[model samples]
Target: MRLSIPIQSHYYERKRIMRLFEAKNLTKKYDKTVLDHLDFSINEGEVVGVIGVSGCGKSTLARLVSGIEKPSSGSLLYQGKPVDFKKGRKDIQLILQNSIESFSPRMKIRVFLYEPYHYFYHLHKNEALDCIKKILKQVGMDESCLEKYPHELSGGQLQRIAIARALIIHPRLLICDEITSSLDHVVQREIIELLKKFVEKNHISILFISHDLSLVHEFCHQVLVLNNGKIIEKGTIQQLYKSENEVVQNLLKAAYLNS
Candidate 1:
C-alpha cells in the first residue's frame, strides 16, 4: 500500500480548456490520514473517472470536492476560485450508490423531487411540480413515478429518480460515487447513456468514481489510478494499459480478473 510513483498525467499541461474543479495537495484525516496529499483537476464538460481499491479514499475525495467534507490541508478550487460552499452550494451536487437512502420513505416521489426547486428557486408546490415533471422527462421518467414511494420502486428506477432530482438543480459539477455499481448491467448502461445525453447539451462536468474499470475506460475522458491515497498514474484508458508502473499493472490485472 506504500507505493509512490511520480505524477505522469498530461492533464496538468493543458492551458486552453477551463478547469471545473481542481484539487492541489488535498489531504483528509480523522484518527488517521484517510487521504494523503493528492492533486487532480477535472475540466469543464469532462467526465473524469477515479478508480482504486476499497477504502482507498475514493468516496472521501468525492466528499471533499462536493464540499460535504473539508480537507485537513490543501485546497479545492471551483472555476479557478476557492470553493465557497456557503454562497454557492447549488453549483455542486453529489449522488451516491445507495439511491434509496437519499429519499424519504414518508414522501412520495413528487415530494422528494420538489425539494430542489423549493430550496433553490423558491417555487410554490404547483410551480415546483411543474418543473419536476419536466425534469423527470429528461431522466426518462413520467408522472406515474411521482406518486410512488421510494420503497415501491426498483433499484434502477429509484436511481434514475435520484439523478433527476440532482439534475433538476442544474449543478455545474456532479460527483457520482459508485452510482451504477449496484444495478444490473443493462440498467447501468441506461443510466450512463442518460448522463451522456445530458452532458451533450449542458456545460456540466462529472467526477465519476467507481471500481468498474471497464466502465471507467469506456465512459471517462481521462482516468486516474488512485492507490495509497495518491494518484500514481493517469491517462486515457488506452495509455494506462501500456503503463510500465507495476502498481497500475496489478490494479488493471485484478480488475480484469474480477470482471
Candidate 2:
C-alpha cells in the first residue's frame, strides 16, 4: 500500500502553511500514566528533539506518533485530521533503538531491506534491488551488505541499515527513539550527520528522541524536555540555554560536563 495524504482542494497552500504532524493533549497509560497530556508539532522539513530521563515517556510518545500504539485519551493528527493507526500510514516511520533485535534472525539483509519496498510500492524484484542499492549507498553502505545477516554487521552498520529501511518509504516524519544510545561517540556522530543529510535532501521532518542533550542540540531546530509525562520545557536550543527551569538547567549542566 503506497500510503499518501489525500489531496485537499487547497493542498498546495496547506502544504506551505500547516504542520506535517501534530499531537494534542496526547496521553498514554498502562497500569499507570506513561505520557500525560503531551502537545507537540512538526513543521515541514524541521527537526524537533525530545529529551527526557529513562521512563519519562519518550518511547511512548514516539509509539503514539508513529501509530505503533494509540494514545489513550488524546488526538494525533496528520495533515490536520485524526490519524488512523489501524490503517498504518507509510509516511510516518519509527526507527527503534535496538537495530539488531528489530530484524528477523533468519532473514538476510536483502529481505530486511526489500520487504518494505515490496509491501509499500509493490516493486518488481529488479526494481526493488535497484532501490535497495541506492538507499544503502546513501547510508554509506555497499551492495555486499545485502548478503549479510544482522549479527554479521557492526552496531554502526546495522543502525545505518535500520535507517535505510525507514527511508525506503520516503516518510514525512521519522520518529527516532534512542537511536544513538548504544553506539560509541564516534559512531553516534556519524549517524547524526547521516540523519542531517537525509532530512535536508528529502525535505521531511523528524521527531528525534534522545537522552543525549548534546546530540539533540547539534541536530534539532527545536527541543522539548519531558518530565513526569509533561513538557517541562520547550524551545530552540538557544532558548533552552536561557531557561530558568531547574530540570532544564541540570540537563544542560550535565551535557556540558560530559562534553
Candidate 3:
C-alpha cells in the first residue's frame, strides 16, 4: 500500500488563519443545560446570526466562541487546531451586550482606544496615539471622543468605542452578543451598517447574537433559531422565510408583521 500526502501548489503557510467554530456534544449547564449537543460551523467571512427569545443560550454560545466560557463537554477548534484562549486571546474579541458595563467609567476614550495598540504593538506613546486617531476616524468617531469618559458619552458613542477596541487587534472573528440591543433604532442601524462595512472591507467573520428577529434578517446571511438551549432551526435568510418549523415561521411572521 502507498501512502501519499496531498501537496498544494499554492500554499502560503503564513496566510491569515481561517476562523472556525466546531462542537461535538458541546453543552453548557448553568442550573440546567443552557446548550445541548450543538454542532455548527461558521466559515470565515460569513455572518452567522443566532436569534431566539431571551435566555435561549444565544449569548452562551457567544461566550463559548469568544473563549469567555468553556463548554461543559466538547471540543472547539479555530483554524483546525484545538482552541486555546491564552494562545489566541487577541484574535477573537467579543463586544458585550451592555455598553454601560463594557467600558470603565474612569477610562477616557483615548485610553480605551489606544490601550490595545500599546499592549499589542509595544508602540511608543506617539505612535499609539497616531494609530488611535486613525482608528477612531475609521469607526466614525471624532477626535473629541478621545477626551470623554464612558459615563459622559451617549450609549451609541460608548458602543462605537467598544467596537473600536475590539477592532484594535484586527481580530479574525467578532462575536457581538446583542451589542445593539440598548441603542435606539437609528443608532442601531448606524452601528449595524458600520459592522457590515467592516466585514466587507476585511475578511472578519461575525456571530451576531440577538433576540430581534427583524434585525437579524436585515444583517445576517444565515440564522440559527435557538429555543430552550437547543437549536430548533438553522438556514439561510431565504430558507428561514420558507421554513415550515413553527418557531422560525412564527418569528419570521412576527418580524414581517411588525416591520
For model 3 the TM-score comes to 0.90
Q: What TM-score would each prediction reach against the true structure?
A: 0.92, 0.91, 0.90
Regions of candidate 3 where Cα sits further than 4 Å from its true position: 1-19
- The 10-residue segment of model 1 with minimum total lDDT is 1-10
- Descending-TM-score candidate ranking: 1, 2, 3
Ten-residue segment with the worst summed lDDT in candidate 2?
1-10
- Return the clash pairs for model 1, or none: none
RMSD of 3: 8.8
User: What digit string (tens of lDDT, one per residue) describes model 3 on residues 1-259?
Assistant: 1112212112224266454665567799888999998877776776788988777888789889888899898878887888889978888899987877977889888887878888888887788888888878888989898988888888898888899889989898899998998888889889988998887788688899877665676677667888888888887666777888897777777666765
Per lDDT, what order, best first? 2, 1, 3
Q: Residue 86's C-alpha lDDT in candidate 1? A: 85
